[model samples]
Target: MVGALIIALGILSAGWLLLKALSRGQTADFTAIRLALARYLALALEFQLGADILSTAISPTWEQLGKLGAIAIIRTALNYFLSREMRDERGQTSAEKPVVERAD
Candidate 1:
């Protein structure tokens, strides 16, 4: 239940950030928004994974273990992709910065 709550919080946080960003009239700043949302989601997934581990420790049934394994794998994959995208976005943002031209 706590894990579920954590996931919900993550989603809510992401939504809040999106709305806040949009409200600021800076639609072009999606990179920052995405990065922030992804970070929250990743942290929430970690908490969920930890919760799953704790649940399994208390009741090590085969079915429970299977479910935990599947969930962990899916969450991990999501986190990996999100992290990769965040890295790419950061690189692109940095590259898009305007270089100052000094007058001689």
Candidate 2:
């Protein structure tokens, strides 16, 4: 539950960063990063919610461990995706333009 909230906060922070990027005219790259972050955040929320449902439905069984495995896998994937999104955000840098060649 706490992890899910952290992921949500990350998504919100990424959104704010993306807004800053867009205001600086970095629409193309920022869009990609923003989408990635949003995706991971949503996935993390879904994973937690589903795990809660699973536990509610099943007290204990061999399937409990299997559900736990699924939860871990989903969380891992979300973490990887979030990492990639952060990298993408950092990559959206404003490149310094080369000075115009001085004509003779």
Candidate 3:
């Protein structure tokens, strides 16, 4: 239940950000918005994994354990890629910024 709620919140927050960006009249900082959404999704995935763990703990069937393992692997992969992408984007953004040289 809590996991679902958190996921729902993430979805709503991302949707709001998208709408806000769209309202900016073609001048929206889309990269920032995408980063924010990715962060939310990654967080939501964590909560979901926790929920799955809890659920499996209550019923230790082999089938349930297998499913949980698969889910965990998939979610972990997703989080890893998301983090990598975010890091790359941040690096790119920083590299694109103009660095001012100090005047002696």
Model 2 residue pairs with clashes: none
Roughly what TM-score does model 1 have, to 2 decimal places? 0.77
Query: Could you tell me every candidate's TM-score relative to the true structure?
Result: 0.77, 0.45, 0.80
Best by lDDT: 3
lDDT of each: 0.83, 0.67, 0.84
User: Residue by residue across 68-102, what tens digits does model 2's lDDT show?
Assistant: 77766876676677667656655554333345888
The prediction achieving the highest TM-score against the true structure is 3
Residues 1-104, candidate 1, lDDT per residue (tens digit)?
Answer: 66567667767877888888788877877777677767777777788888889989996999999999999899899889988998999999999999999999
True-structure lDDT of candidate 3 = 0.84
Residue-wise C-alpha lDDT for candidate 3, range 1-104, written one tens digit per residue? 66667667767887887787678775535677778778877887898899899989997899999999999999999999999999999898889889999999
Model 1 scores worst on lDDT over the 10 consecutive residues at: 1-10
Which residue runs does candidate 2 get wrong by more than 4 Å?
Answer: 31-60, 77-104
Residue ranges of candidate 1 with Cα displaced over 4 Å: 1-24, 101-104
1 against 3, candidate with superior lDDT? 3
* After superposition, candidate 3 runs with Cα above 4 Å error: 15-29, 101-104
